[model samples]
Target: MIIEPRIQNPASLLPDAVKAINLLYKAAHSAGVPDSTLELVHLRASQINGCSACVDAGARGARKAGETEERLYAVAVWRETPYFTEAERAALALAEAATRLADRADAVSDDVWAEAARHFDEKELAAIVLWVATTNFFNRINAATRQPAPQTWG
Candidate 1:
């Protein structure tokens, strides 16, 4: 196994950033977006970004929320799987599009946005969007820092 050095202790080196992230997390949970949906979005974005730390953490979070292992494993191929509901699929699509912005000119297309909007109210949609962005933020940081997955995340 190749062990990589973490350059900084982000929580200590950037307390304000950590606080801001905590604030976002709190707001997201309070925004009425379902915990299951938030976990799906976070896992999808982390998978797209190749962030092992976030992926592992997300899996743990999902399990705690009573998500099925089959569904967790199928998040990467959500479109080809029957494990998700229409709303979950829409959230996953939004997560992918938002994470892979460079893959297309219009990253979050109107159709994707419309589909997500169909399943979520304006407040919930806002929370989902923020959740996606926050997950991507953590994904990039972990990828860049070569952060390792925790032995346990429960």
Candidate 2:
């Protein structure tokens, strides 16, 4: 495990993180992804990254948006569950591909892209990509910083 010791000074990387987050937030809002799907993608990415804070926040967001506990728990094993729609499946695939970047040595494959394309237009696709990227950034920061989650991310 990489144990980053607490430093007296904030890392020089903080500003860059904020910039990327701001850009992604703008893109996500402009892309018009439904709030539910956004929360789902965030949760899925957090799960993949093993970021507990993100998981907690995303789960609360899902619950506040009326998602069932069963479905929330099942998200980690989504393929084995029947709670998701085709669109949701596609988005999940995108999230997985984005999070496990090393595994997809060939990069985003035609099949995955096609699946996402079927469910999302260009603008929506942009949103989906931004969502995956942004969530990954947040996961890394929160995991590395050992930040605790707030009671609500709604």
Candidate 3:
């Protein structure tokens, strides 16, 4: 079976969307969170949202940045694995909490926020949150358009 994308890229419709997103991405990257960790956060949110496009790109991004295969394979089942560091775990928790906002009344509970705060400073946490939000934004769009995952991506 084949699933074609509804469009090549939604951002292309808005002339400035890609540039604006790229600039936002640069700001997120500047905030002090490890690149791998941000990739992990992005992957996790995309996974939850069932955005195969982002998932494929995120895994590739993580791997290209030297993320271990063992860790990448375990991202979907991270809680059961010991591959992640405490900081990564905290970031993941925050990502999950933030992503699944409708699953619970509190959305991001205090415990989850506290755990993330324990590991990241204000700037880093802000970046992680931004990354998660950014990932979700893309995920929702891709899922809506049924965007096909790329065979080879940059």
Candidate 4:
């Protein structure tokens, strides 16, 4: 079945908002965090949100940052996968907890936060959190607009 998007590039209609989002998203790429880790967090959050556009883009972005197919495929089940490092595991845990805030009263539990803290310093933690937030923001925008994935895979 062919599905048409509700809006054709909504960001193009809101250029100012698009620029602001672009700027904030750009700033979220902090120097303290690794690009690979940031890509993982973005992909995981997009996966959870079921945002196809994000999933597709995140996968492409992750690969561009030198991520392996195994790691990308295992992102959703990182706990059971040995493809990730301890630090990457901690960041993924934090990303899941932060992204699924409505699932629990204590959305981001202390254990998750503590684990992430053990792996990352203050600045790096801030960067990961910002990446999750921006990813969620993009996911919402894309999902709401029913923006289709641009491609199947790279």
Candidate 5:
């Protein structure tokens, strides 16, 4: 494999940044969102961002969470697929909308927000939003740094 990482791991080089991100992660998880749903959101956002490392890591996390391969593979085309529930579809739509803010004049439209709200309560919705944002943040960083997918997450 090619050496793709442009620099040392930011978590090691900048402990404060890592701590902040870790705190955000902890807060995101405390919102009571399901692990599978969170992983799906992360994977979908990473896919949209074209971040291979995040995609790889998200896929592994989904698998560990008992997500089927068929469902995971269909996440990119979830709208046309029958693999996801209405709730999952809403979350995916929200993730796409939030991640592709420049795709339209009004990103995260009312309809999308309403759909997500219907499926998740306020706290859950907050967690999902934070999860999407955090995933996108990592996606941008990994893409910019040319970080390669790790062989294993351990």
Candidate 6:
């Protein structure tokens, strides 16, 4: 399959996308979202978006970070599973909200935001949003680029 327009690589011609990614990444780390959670969010969002490349990268990253295969497999059905903690559920909700941003102007509704805030502070909330947005961005890039999942992430 031919991946059409490479968004980040031609950033000189698409500065906005690049800048947005840079700022978003910085904000995500600042928001206090842990690396493991961030990776989970990315993987889950990729799953939802059907972005194979992002899913591959996220799953591999999670595994490398010592995330259990049980949890990784349970991510899609997190609401029904016992593998994840309440904190992980909250982040997943935030991820869904961000991934479906176009559906509602305020994709992250007050209730969802509040639920997330109960588990995380302002910085963490920012990180959650950033993580969500960043993963979505990567999904878009990989989807557009037709980037394939590597045989192995190591």
Which candidate's lDDT is highest? 3
Compared with the true structure, all predictions reach lDDT values of: 0.89, 0.82, 0.93, 0.90, 0.92, 0.81
| Candidate 5 lDDT over residue span 19-134, tens digit each | 89999899888988888999999999999999998999999999999999999999999999899989989999999999999999999999999999999999999999999999
- Which segments of model 1 are wrong by more than 4 Å? 152-154
Query: Of the candidates numbered 1 and 2, which has the greater TM-score value?
Result: 1
Estimated TM-score per prediction? 0.94, 0.82, 0.96, 0.94, 0.94, 0.80
Best of the two (4, 6) by lDDT: 4
lDDT of 1 by residue, 31-60 (tens): 887899899899999998998889998998
User: Against the hidden true structure, what lDDT does model 1 obtain?
Assistant: 0.89
What TM-score does structure 3 among the candidates reach?
0.96
For residue 83, what is the lDDT in candidate 1?
93
Candidate 2 TM-score over all chains jointly: 0.82
- What shift in Å separates residue 4 of candidate 6 from its native position after superposition? 10
Model 6: per-residue Cα lDDT at residue 4: 45
- Compared to the true structure, candidate 5 yields what TM-score? 0.94
Q: In candidate 2, how many clashes are counted?
A: 0
Identify the candidate with maximal TM-score. 3
Tens digits of lDDT, candidate 4, 5-53: 8997678888888888877777778547889999999999999999988
For the record, the alpha-carbon RMSD of candidate 4 to the native fold, in angstroms, is 1.6
Q: Clash totals for all models, in order? A: 0, 0, 0, 0, 0, 3
lDDT by residue (38-126, candidate 6, tens digit) is 88999999998889878988998899878998998898999999888788888899889889888898888998888888999887887
Extract clashing residue pairs from model 2: none
Q: How much lDDT does candidate 3 score?
A: 0.93
Select the stronger candidate by TM-score from 2 and 4.
Answer: 4
- Tell me how candidate 2 scores on lDDT: 0.82
Query: Looking at candidate 4, what is the lDDT of residue 107?
Result: 97
